[model samples]
Target chain A: GESVGLHLPTLSVQEGDNSIINCAYSNSASDYFIWYKQESGKGPQFIIDIRSNMDKRQGQRVTVLLNKTVKHLSLQIAATQPGDSAVYFCAEIRGNTGKLIFGQGTTLQVKP
Target chain B: GAGVSQTPSNKVTEKGKYVELRCDPISGHTALYWYRQSLGQGPEFLIYFQGTGAADDSGLPNDRFFAVRPEGSVSTLKIQRTERGDSAVYLCASSPARNNEQFFGPGTRLTVL
Candidate 1:
């Protein structure tokens, strides 16, 4: 069975600091990976994504690093702010299917 | 009107009852998907629809679960004889094409007591 999972269940960071969330997947065939931020009572919002062909992708203040060799993925948020506090999930897309398998979320708490 | 939307934000029913969850994808989107998320767990793929037909239904847990999208815009996920363990948040997302970026709705929180 293929599974996408996170390395931590919760992470606490102070405002003005950088935050990193890690994910390790067992599906090597998965070509695409995405990061989603989900605030309480809201749907998961797309943050950034990376393809297997590339190892890294960056958004406004977010970065996604993919290590296909070890099936590892990580999301980096710079200058973490209180507004960045949320549950973050990493999802991998299955080839040819619109299905995205989500990983156990990492709850990020940013304190000012 | 811009993003995916779900109805009845919350659902509560007794065990052995049946319930239906609705999802409205973004207009003109061709791909719709259903996912289940239990507390403290990640969302699990339930089923996927490409246009008016189901392209993949392998993630459906059992016979008690079913889904349909006749016109390919809105979809309904039906659960029959729901049990206590069937309680969870049902999430719906839509994408313009296969494997493309998807937009998710707020999700329907189902509690089977």
Candidate 2:
């Protein structure tokens, strides 16, 4: 089955440092991608999104980079803060269906 | 502006019982979604409603899982003959339209013992 997967299960980063999380997806037909942050006991929160036509999209302090050739996506967070400690997931939307297929999350541990 | 909201933040039920989870989407949002997330994984799509109709429900695991959005606002996910595997965090999200960013609520955590 086509799926999205993360490269690492846990990523430890020191406060004030930059953090990067990577995801690989198998579906070549996916046209949209999103990154979500989920804290303890809470639902996933929308972070940033990018379209397949665009290679990169930037948010406040976050950036999403997409490589369509390799079917890869990455989320970069600048100046990591303690509040950023949570599980991060990359999801791909099925064409026109708005159904998000998520990858096994990567836990971002920001150490203060 | 309020985001999505779910009822019964936590539910503990025995096996073979039935459960209904409710979702109150953001005002005027026309799209609502339901997902189930186990302990160590991401949220899995279950159903989606667009303006009082279920546009897609391909992700529903089985016939025991059902959902409705009769008024195009509040939606409910009903599960019958619940088993231990049904114990997971049920999350609801809403978007202003299709292909838009979804706002999620604090999920309802169900523990089926």
Candidate 3:
């Protein structure tokens, strides 16, 4: 069965520090990947996305690195803030199917 | 400019009851999706619609679950004979097109007792 998994269930970071979250996917046919953040009592918010052709994509304060060879994905947040504390999810779309298969989230906790 | 919206932010129902969840997508968005999130887990895809028809429904758990997008803008997910296992947060999302960035709505929490 195709599935996505996270390397850790929780990540604690100090304020102003950088945070890294890791994920692994089982499907080789997946081409597009996205990272989302979800706060308590809210929906998953889109953070950044990367296609299989690109290994790295950067947003305002976040970065997504993809490793096709290892079937690994990671999300990096710079200058972590208290607002950045949330559960992060990595999702992938297989081929052209619009459906997203999401991994169990990794909770990111930023300490002041 | 509004994001996806779902009605009845929360619903409480009993086993063997029927329930309907609604989702209103962003204006002009042609693609709509529905997902389910269990406690301490990520959202799971249920179905996606392109315009007025469902493009993929293979993620639907069983025949008891059904969804419809009659006008391509608003979607309704209906559950028949709901079970305790059906309790979860139902999320809706919309995008300008398929394979694009999807904006999500505050999910509807369903509690089946």
- In candidate 1, the residue pairs with backbone N, CA or C atoms under 3 Å apart (3 or more residues apart, or in different chains) clash, namely none
lDDT of 1: 0.93
Instruction: Go through the candidates in order and give the clash count of each.
Output: 0, 0, 0
Per-residue alpha-carbon lDDT of candidate 3 for residues B2-112, written as tens digits (9 for 90 to 100): 788998899999999999999999999999999999999989999999999998998899999999999889999999999999999999999999988899999999999
In model 1 chain A, the worst 10-residue window by lDDT is: A92-101
Candidate lDDT scores, in order, read: 0.93, 0.94, 0.94
Quote the lDDT for B20 in model 1. Answer: 95
Best-to-worst ranking by DockQ:
2, 1, 3
Chain B, per-candidate TM-score = 0.98, 0.98, 0.99
> Which parts of model 2 have CA positions greater than 4 angstroms off?
none
Candidate 2 interface RMSD, angstroms, 1 decimal = 0.7
Q: Assess candidate 1 and give its TM-score to the true structure.
A: 0.97
Sorted on lDDT, best first, the list reads 2, 3, 1
CAPRI band of model 2?
high
Please give the DockQ score of every candidate, comma-separated.
0.84, 0.88, 0.84
Best by lDDT: 2
True contacts kept of 3: 0.77
